[model samples]
Target: MKVANKNIVVTGGGNGVGRELTLKLLSKGAKVIAIDVNQFALQETFRISGKNPNLLIRVLDITDKESVFNFAEEIVSSLGHIDGVINNAGIIQPFIDLKDLKFEQIDRIMNVNFFGTLYMTKAFLNHLLTRPEAHIVNVASMGGFFPFPGQNSYGASKAAVKLMTEGLYSELLGTNVHVSIVFPGGIATDIMKNSDITDKAASDSEKNSKLLLSPAAAASKIISGMEKNKYRLFVGKDSKIMNFMYGINAGFATRLIKRVMGSKMSMEA
Candidate 1:
């Protein structure tokens, strides 16, 4: 897809992947509408982006369906057309087991990740379908394929996205609308810091974060895949490695991962 002049919306366009993506799109000359729940973060992104002519920010809560629909209406009223949507808004809960997980937390995760994706997709369908070739890219995670301990809720939400996006792709097979899913292994961002629900202790010796890929690196990979209209793309070498390992022996590998990560968590605790 030609990068310049295209209309694009990127959710969670604040201080991490979203921020970098919005910046890149603007640099490429795309008209961008950046959406985020935190007005402060959105403002920070704008400040960093430095008054681009092709950018707008919407401070929004993705879980609010009414707000999303209204926001879509507003965008259509102004832009007249939307060429693509990056369903990138998502939340990760504190590392905890299901039994220890609060009902509120689970609801928050589901509402923001799964239902939010649905709401955005639904809200923008008319606009996207109107275009001859439109794109909807949903960011699932490697955890979607293999459940990660202490992140069961997050994993479940992303797994649903994986299936939902695939279903979307198949459903729109004959239509001009194109849907793609992304499964990033790990990308270094303040995601964990942004997601920390409450005060927690840390181990003295820091272990390397699994999120090894930088946001810029991830953005490049994403844009590359979108250009080819690939159905799915993994952002990191580790993502591909995980895919292979999981595909080869899911049961065994899953257990092995759990053991390893569990050991780390235990040590940290």
Candidate 2:
């Protein structure tokens, strides 16, 4: 589907990948509604977009179904119809091994990363169903395809997203809305920060993690995936590795991921 003249909604558009994609969508002549909890980042994004008249930013918390549903209603009211919806808003919990993982952290991850996306998609489903041709893009992760130690909550959350998107695709087959899932690797972004690793040791280790692509680069590929209506989009080498492992078995993949993640940090050093 062409992006030009389309009304697009991007969640988590305050910063990082979401912001980058929104900018690109606008460049493609699409009207965008950016939703994020960080108003400061929203202001920055708006400023960066040069006061474009086709942009709208709202502070939103997706976990609240009512809030998200209401927000979608507002968008449809103002924009006439939504041509694309990107479920990009998500959070990463602290890096904790399954042995020492906190239950609260796990709950938080599921709340935002999985439930949040679900709520947003559900809220907009009726609207999307009405459109002649629409797109639904869910930003999953390489972690979803391949598990890693210290990524219990993060991986699980994205894995849920993967299944949810696939189910949506199956349900909407031959419909106007095309569904796509994205798996991004070590892009230069602040997702590690979202992991809540405030300790100097973990912070330093995360800071040195390999950055294979810029946020803008990943965002470009993601947007391209939407245009082509791809079933899945992989970003960077990590995604390729995960895809190969996924073909084997998720059980064996878990062990392989643990071994790989152990070396990933040291190799980064």
Candidate 3:
């Protein structure tokens, strides 16, 4: 579905790719409602957008199902209707193996990454079905399909999102509501800080990496995918390459990632 002149909602719009998505949507003449848990970050995004009238920023925590449903109701009541929703809000676990990781960390990761997307999707789906053309975009991760050492739980949560989105696509096949699942590789963003993970090894590795995609470029790809109603989108060159590698041999791909990322994770633990 075309986004121009349509009302689209993007979660986690305060920072990172979500912020970039909000800005780009505005540029495309879409009425954007950008929601994030961080009020200050939402303000920053608003300021960065020059406080565009077409952009609306709201502070929301997607993990809260009741609040999510209420917010969806409010948006439709106030704005008349919504054309799309991009579930982009998520957080990663600490750089620790599953055995050593605390249960709290796993719960938080699942709540925000998987359940949060579920709530948001369920909340807006009915409204989306009412529109002539509507879209639902869920942002999973490359880890969702490939194994990453010290991020097993995080990968699992995203993997759930991946399947859930795919299922939604199948269920809505003949409907006006289009579903798209996105698998994004490494992107230049403050995810470590945002996730409240302070691992020096992980931080150093990400900081020195030159291969990560920029948030703006990632957002552009996501929007383009949405416009075309793609069922699945791989956001970065690394994600695309890894997807192909995994398709060839899942065992080899898993071993390769463990060999590369395990060393860095060992340094942290």
Candidate 3, after superposition: displacement of residue 65 in Å?
0.7
TM-score of each: 0.94, 0.90, 0.95
Per-candidate local distance difference test: 0.86, 0.85, 0.93
Q: For candidate 3, lDDT tens digit of each residue in 187-267?
A: 988888789995432455664578888789999999999999999999999999999999999999998988878776678
lDDT of 1 by residue, 1-269 (tens): 55578999999898677888899888888898999988999888888888776889999888999999999999988988889999888878888899999999999899988999999999999888889788999999988899788899999999999999999999999898878899987777667666666444222222235447777778878877876789989889878988889999999878988998999899979
List of clashing residue pairs for candidate 1: none
How many Å off is the CA of 180 in candidate 3? 0.5
Model 3 accuracy (lDDT, Cα)? 0.93
Best by TM-score: 3
- The global Cα lDDT (0 to 1) of model 2 is 0.85
Mark the regions of model 2 whose C-alpha exceeds 4 Å error after superposition: 199-211, 249-253, 264-269
Weakest ten-residue segment in model 3 by summed lDDT: 199-208
What is the TM-score (0 to 1) of candidate 3?
0.95
lDDT of 2 by residue, 222-254 (tens): 988899889988988878877887787877877
lDDT score, candidate 3, position 155 = 97
